[model samples]
Target: MAAIYQVDSFTKLPFSGNPAGVYISDVEQDYETCIKIAREMNLSETAFPVRTTDDNHYRLRWFTPTTEVPMCGHATLATSWVHFTELGIDGDIYYETLSGQLKVSRIGDDLKMDFPSELPFRIDLDQSIGEALDCNGMAYYSTGTRKLLFEISDRKKLEGLHPDFSKMEKLSVGVPLRGLIVTCKGDGEFDFFSRYFAPWVGINEDPVTGSAHTVLGPFWSERLGKDKLRAYQASQRGGEIRLEILDGNRISIIGNAVTVIRGQMLV
Candidate 1:
């Protein structure tokens, strides 16, 4: 029997964060089976725990309903929560991912993830990408993923702005992956608020993306002149994150996890 645990990552309380389905098994499933199960689960992402060098260390792979993603921090955090809190695995847990080794540590009520940094490079804003999104924005940039970072003259523009999904899908085809639209100094609660659209990758909007923060957090921290910052994903189903810029190559992302559902699956 395989056990499936439903957990909400990046929020301490249940029903408040990104929910992920985690599958634990003694034997790892083939790639096709993993993708099939992930599609069936139909969560933002599903994590599979594979054999590792030690019991405390394991390999994890993340699959969206449509395809496999290289890495996912929120799902990784949820995976850690299930292993540590439910399965009673103690200490820092190590996961070998396609993106490389990731370390997760439990600190009090928050789970901190040590992940690699994805720095954004400067790019010119042009009408081509804008036409692709069919939204008016002032500026843009590109992280590992294409980004539309615009400064709104008025915050009200944010509340009323909507992009054409068809245009966004067209824009995504031009770029290697989907693009993210972010507004700086628009929300008073946090440094910035963002909406991720990746139709190419099968996600319209991710509730809270910890991996994306691997790029956004440090970018804001350096600009804000503070090592630590608070982030909010302004999706209808909102989520929050506490980010700290560590050494040049690493970052510490702090968020709480909530276990929403627990069940067993026959494999």
Candidate 2:
């Protein structure tokens, strides 16, 4: 048996942020077994962290319901939350992942994750994407990751989107990206507002995606002329993220997480 925790990342409140399953094991499990467990959990993404030879370090992997991803931000946050709050591990922790070494630390009530910045390059908007989303945006861009970033002109339009998931999935077939991010200038307390859709990766809409912000932070920082920004993801279950573009092609994603479920995975 192994302990599994369901944590809501990027928000202090329960049921408001992205939920991820964190599976901490005493022994390393094979890739197929991890995939099977991820399928069983059926979350947007599940994280598995195995102990490493180095003290305070672990090899981490993330899996969507359908496929394994190279990196995941919310799941990583959930993993760190489980380690700090549940397992009683303290101080900074290092995660060795497919994307390389990632560092996470606790600060006050928030958990800060140091992730690589993936700035997007401007690209011509595909008509199929417009057809699938049924909206127009300021511009379209693609990051190194398998994701496209769409900058809309209006925040309300970005928030009012009703995408055809099947159409999106069909259109995204064979495309190198996982999903699309629609964003716009925010109002009031938020500097930007955005939403994420990745039907190809088994997630139709991610409530608060930290990894997507890795691209967003730099993109918006250049346009808005500010390195630090407050962003809001306008999903059904909305959440917030504090984004800062750091030096050396890195970014800091700051958010709070709450554990909503704790149990042992009997399987």
Candidate 3:
């Protein structure tokens, strides 16, 4: 049996944001064990944080129900929330992940995560993808993280998309894709609004993604000409994110998480 923490990331209220399972351990969980735990939890992603010899640094990994992903934002936020609140960790928390070394810090009641800024490379829109999303794409960009970004000129079209998940996966037959990001320019409320779909990674839709913002923070900043931006993920259980572009190609993702369940996984 192992302890498991359920946290609602990118929101202050319960059941209104992306829910993630967090398992913190002194020793690393094996690949099979982590997969089993993630499957049991059945969240979009589960975070595994194994302590390192260093004081505050840990090796962090994320897994979906069926496979492991290179980076996960909500799960990472949930893990940090568990540590800072439940476990009583004090100063900055450091995590070594597949993406790179990540750092989390506390500011008042919110958490700030330092992630690499990836301005996606422009690409020609795939007609099949446009058909799958049922919307005309303004521009398309692909990132090194294997995330595909499709920007639409109209926010209403971005919000009203009903994607065919099966076709979304099939459209990138020869391409390596982790997920598809659909976004548009926001109107007064936020700088932009987005929705993420990842049938390829076993998640039909992600409620609130933090990693996706790394690419978005930079992409929108360049277009809007601002270093600071606010975004909203227009999922059913919506969430908000505050972004700040830092020096040296990095972005700060700021959000609040609420711990909803404190229990043990008896698997």
Best by TM-score: 3
Q: Write the per-residue lDDT of candidate 1 for residues 1-267, one digit (tens) a residue.
A: 889988988776777778899999989888898988898789989999876868678989999988888878889989999988999887999999987889989888888899887666555555655565455555556545444455443445554556666676765334455446555553557877665665667887777888878777767776788888888767666788888888856888889888888888765
TM-score of 3: 0.97
Question: Per-residue alpha-carbon lDDT of model 2 for 64-114, expressed as tens digits?
Answer: 878889879999999999999999888899999998899999998889999
In model 2, what is the error at residue 247, expressed in angstroms? 0.9
TM-score of each: 0.90, 0.96, 0.97
Backbone Cα, N, C clashes tallied per candidate? 1, 2, 0
Residue 76 lDDT in candidate 2: 95
User: Ranking by lDDT, best first?
Assistant: 3, 2, 1
Report the error of model 3 at residue 106, Å: 0.4
Candidate 1: C-alpha RMSD after superposition = 2.3
The positional error of residue 255 in candidate 1, measured at the CA in angstroms, is 0.2
Model 1 lDDT-worst window of ten: 145-154
List, residue by residue over 233-261, the lDDT tens digit for candidate 3. 99999999999999988899999999999
Candidate 3 global Cα RMSD: 1.2
Q: What is the C-alpha lDDT of each candidate?
A: 0.76, 0.87, 0.89
